[model samples]
Target: MEALVAITIGTLTAVGLYLTLRLRSFPVILGLTMLSYAVNVFLFASGRLVQNQAPIIGSGETYADPLPQALVLTAIVISFGMTAVIMIMAIGGFLESGHDRVNMAASDPADADQDDAEEGWA
Candidate 1:
């Protein structure tokens, strides 16, 4: 069980990093989300993996730590808000620039001039 959780976290982290290196805004946002999910899973696993155990401590019985669970919950909420904000920013950027790239290079003067001409700002 622990191995499975570990593998899952590792896989998520790997995929997230791969996607994060992409040039497009949407993939970057998705990568960040996956990274957050990996972090949440890791944090949750830190509380132990005992089955059939309650979060509350009881007399002579094993209880999973609730702190990690609480932290994961908080992280989930924060990540959701962050994802929403990033998506909105991406959309706005796309609308303004006509591209979904996060880091556009300024190496092409012709393209720049064309864009300026199209926008009537040349």
Candidate 2:
């Protein structure tokens, strides 16, 4: 069970990092989302993996730590908000630039004038 969780976290982190390095906005967003999921899972797993265990302390039986659960919950909310903000920013950037690429070409004034002349605009 622990091994499975570890593998899941590793896979998520690897995929997230891979997508984060992409030159497009959509994939970068996905990568960040994946990274957040990985973090949430890791935080949740830190509490405990035991079944039928309550989170309350001072009990006779084994109790799981509630801190991790709370942390995971908070992380989920934060990640959601973060994703939404990034999405809005990406949309705005796309609308302004007509593309969602991260690596935009350097628009020098000289180059613009040369292109305009070539196109018979000037």
Candidate 3:
């Protein structure tokens, strides 16, 4: 069972990474979401993959690590906020540039020269 869960997590991470590398905004967003889900699941699973374990704490119960569960829950909420912000930024970029390119915006000449100098390129 543990092996199967590990394999599943690996597969999900791989798929998410692959999708993340695509040349599209929506797919990248989805990939980020998938990756976040995989990471949250992996973190949650680190508390031991106990079956039917109650998230609540009480007497006479073998509870899984509550810390990981709490952290995962926090991550999920934070990811939702991040997703919303990314979506709005993407939409704004699309409106401004008329394209959904995910690559970094071209640097200004001044900054480019500074960066080159910093990198010892010029």
TM-score of each: 0.85, 0.83, 0.76
- Candidate 1: regions farther than 4 A off: 108-122
> What is the alpha-carbon lDDT of model 1 when measured against the actual structure?
0.88
In model 2, where do residues sit more than 4 Å from their true spots? 107-122
Ranking by lDDT: 1, 2, 3
Instruction: State residue 39's C-alpha deviation in candidate 2, in Å.
Output: 0.3
Residue-wise lDDT of candidate 3 within 4-101, one digit each (tens)? 88887888898889989988788898888888988988998888988877666773367667889889989999999999999998898778767786
Of the candidates numbered 1 and 2, which has the greater lDDT value?
A: 1
Off by over 4 Å in 3: 55-58, 104-122
Full candidate order by TM-score, most accurate first: 1, 2, 3
What Cα-based lDDT does every candidate model obtain?
Answer: 0.88, 0.87, 0.81
